[model samples]
Target: MRFAISIPQFYADGEFDPAAFRAYFARAEALGCYESAWAQEMTLSASPQLSPLEAMTYAAACTSTLRLGCVVFVTTLHSPVHLAKSLATLDQLSGGRLEVGVGTGGPQRPFAAFGVDRSRYLARFTEGLALTKALWTRDSVTFDGEFWQLKDARMEPKPAQKPYPRLWFGASGDGALRRAVRLGDGFFGAGSSSTAAFAAQVSVVREALAAAGRPAAEFPIAKRIYIGIDSDAARARQRVNAALAGIYGRRVPAIEEAAVAGTVADCVAAARAVAAAGAELILFTPLYEVPEHAGQIAAEIIPQLG
Candidate 1:
């Protein structure tokens, strides 16, 4: 199984430690278990978190071989032109080591705050995705889109990766999973989904690919799993719950239940279930005590997986 780790984002005001952050990547690279490092996006949140692109750029500078990306940018809330330009620039800056993940950000998001029409966000998402890809690959683009339009537009300095970077979709429902198969290079299961639910989603993705006459082997599948490791299982559970609550702004029982926490053996068993559920790439995201969890997971859990 391919293993990846979440790049550290949790920070307090005036508490950003450059040395520690750089050290985290350095250590992960030295361990030789991680193929990539990922960041998550939350444009408007109660938590103080760095922007995914900025964090990813910093990570790219710190580590040479580790691929960097964001799990899902709320595409509906963004200006496609600006977002596309930024991602293309990031891909170039990272020397083509970029994977783009996007989603509609759900109906619950504060759409009005971002000037998004809640009812028509999905259309905006799909159109925006098309526009972004066009900007990346097209030399001069002329397009008429409902949300955006361009006439003979030229985007210089194309991405380092040919045909642009890989696009991964963060989706849950059957319809969205099918769209992932239709439009994205991969499907990324959310951290909030239970193992059974994730497995079901994977089934839908595979079926969609089959119906589309696309080979499943060409489209990768990945999942972000909230995880923690501690000998005292109860403590691990408590820590993960508290962390999720802080991130989500409330207590979500489903999210708490979905997290993997406890001893090394317990985590191994849970990760095995994820692999069995069809997650070729498992992104281990520790919400609290990140460095310690990263170290232990790389040293203990990854070896056990192999």
Candidate 2:
């Protein structure tokens, strides 16, 4: 199974130091612990945040072999032509090591701010995805669609990767799952997802792939997982809970249950279970209190698995 690390660039307290983040990536690269690194996207949110694309672009410059990705980009917020060109530029700058993850977007306020009709978000998302993919593959294309229309439009500087970089879709509910299966090259789900829920989602993706006459192996499956590693399981739990509570403005009971905690062996076993459940890659999202826990995982859990 492939392993990756996700940095939470958002925080409720304290300023984010770019130098420290660069150091973190340096350490992670030196250890050879991760195949890729990813960042979360949140626009117009009530917290200190860094732009995911900008951070990933910086990371691409800092590391040589590690692939960089944004967990999910809100496609409904931007015009397809502008987004396609921007992503193509990012792919070229990153040396073809970019994976674009798209979502329909959530929350009414952000859509309102962007002047996107909340009721037509799904339709816009679908049309935008088609347009972006077309732009990546073809030279000049004309399309007439419900949300957008173009006449002989062309996008220059195609992605460095052949055909285009991989596209992953983030899904939560049944409708979202169907949409992802219909268009996405891969699937993404929340870190707090249960084993049964993950299994169901995987089954849906696999069946969809088969129905579409595509090989299952053609697409990679990635899931975000919250992790807190310490010698004491209780201490690990406490650290994760504190971070979640601080961010959400209330205690989150699900955080304690969803997080992978305890000793190195315990965390490894949990990772194995996730792999067995069909996740090819797990993006571990750790709380700020124990950011070094990733180092511990690299030193201990990875060795055991290897």
Candidate 3:
């Protein structure tokens, strides 16, 4: 299984320390424990955050080989053309070490703020995905769709990865899982989802791929795990809950249960269950005391995952 980590981005006010951020990447890259580093996009939220693209770009500049990505960029709320170009440029800047993730983010997003009609958002998401792919892979494109129209559009500097970067679709529902099988290069399970839920989703994706006669080997399955490591189980759980509340702006019980917080053995068992659930790639996202958790994971947790 492949392992990864989350990039630090939840900085508020004048709290961002550039030197510390650079040091984090340097240490993470030198460890060679993680195959890639990922960020999350929160365009509109109470959480003070940095944009995923900018964070990934900065992290890319700090490391020579570590891949950088956002797990899911609520593409439905963005301009496909602009998003595509930005990602393409980032891919070039990072020397092809870019992973592209997209998701509808469900109907709960503030669509009206982005001038989007909630009823037709699924259509918009599908069209936007198509348009983005066209922009990335084609020299010239003429397209007419329900939401977008373009004639002989040209996007310079195609992504460094041939065709495009690995297209990962973040999904939860069975229908969405099927859609990922139909359109995405891989499926990414959200960190908020419990291990049981991810197992069910993976079953749906696998069945859909089998029905479509697609090779499962070509489609990677990954999940982001919210982790808290400490010998004091109760304290670790409390810290994880508090950090999650800060990140999400409230206490979400389901997500709290989803987070793995306890002793090292407790974390190992939880992560093993995820791998058995079909997550070939597991991204460890330490909420608080990131560097300390990273050290624990590298020294005490990861070696035992096997």
Candidate 4:
């Protein structure tokens, strides 16, 4: 399975330091240990954070080889036409190394703050995805949808990649899984999901692929996992839990339940389980306090998988 790292845009102190984050990505690429680097999107959070798009743009500029991705952009917050254009621009600028992942906006505050009708988020997400795809592949597009209307409008300087950059969906429910199979190139399982829960969602996605007459191999699967590795398993777990409490203002149940933390052997075992469950890519989000722990994972745990 491919391995990637996620950089938190906000720190425990509720401040963001873009330059420091960019330096981390540079170091990750230099280590020759990551396949991609992704950013998270949290629209109306209680913390200070850099926007996902801005973070991605910065990472794209700093790294030449590591694929740049958005873990998932909230689709219901912006016009698809505008978002498509912005993403296409990034794709062009990044030399075709952009992977776009999107989800229906969550957290009522963001939707309410942005003046988006929360009731129609799902419909808007579907319509926006359809429009974005058309804009990328077709020379021109005209569509009349419930939320948007376009008249022979065309987006230029199409993404460097053919059709468009790879599109992934971050989904949590059965309906979202079905929609992802129908519309996306891949699905990103929720970060907090259990192994059993991930297995169920993967089954749903595969079934949708089958019903659509699409080969399962054509669609990749990705999962975000919190990982902490140290010589002492108990210490590792404590560190991860501490980080979670700092970031989320609550305690994570345990490494076994909410994260992958332990000695190197234990972490490898956890990753192996996820791979066995059919996850093609595993994106690691190191606990907040131990962001640098990712480098240790790159050096110690990832090599064992091969």
1-306: candidate 1 lDDT, tens digit per residue: 898999988887998999999999999899888999999999777788888989999999998899998999888889989989988898899899998899988888899998888899899999999999999999999989998989999997888899989999999988899989899999999999999999999999999999999989899999999998888999999999989988888899998999998989999999999999999999999988898888899888888877
Winning candidate number (lDDT): 3
User: How well is each residue in 1-306 modelled by candidate 3, as lDDT tens digits?
Assistant: 899999998889999999999999888987778899999998887788899999999999999999999999999999999999999999999999999899998999999999999999999999999999999999998999998899999999999999899999999999999999999999999999999999999999999999999999999999999999888999999999999998888999999999999999999999999999999999999999887777788778788876
Q: After superposition, how far is residue 128 of candidate 1 from its true place, in Å?
A: 0.3
Q: Give RMSD (Å) of candidate 3 vs. truth.
A: 0.8
* lDDT (tens digit, per residue) of candidate 4 on 159-228: 8999888889998789889988888899987677777788899999988999999988889999888877
TM, every model:
0.99, 0.91, 0.99, 0.91
lDDT of 2 at 136: 92
Runs off by more than 4 Å, candidate 2: 11-14, 106-110, 289-291
How many pairs of residues in model 1 come into backbone collision? 0
Q: Roughly what TM-score does model 3 have, to 2 decimal places? A: 0.99
Put the candidates in lDDT order, highest first. 3, 1, 4, 2
Range of the 10 consecutive residues with the lowest summed lDDT in candidate 4: 247-256
lDDT value, residue 165 of candidate 3: 97
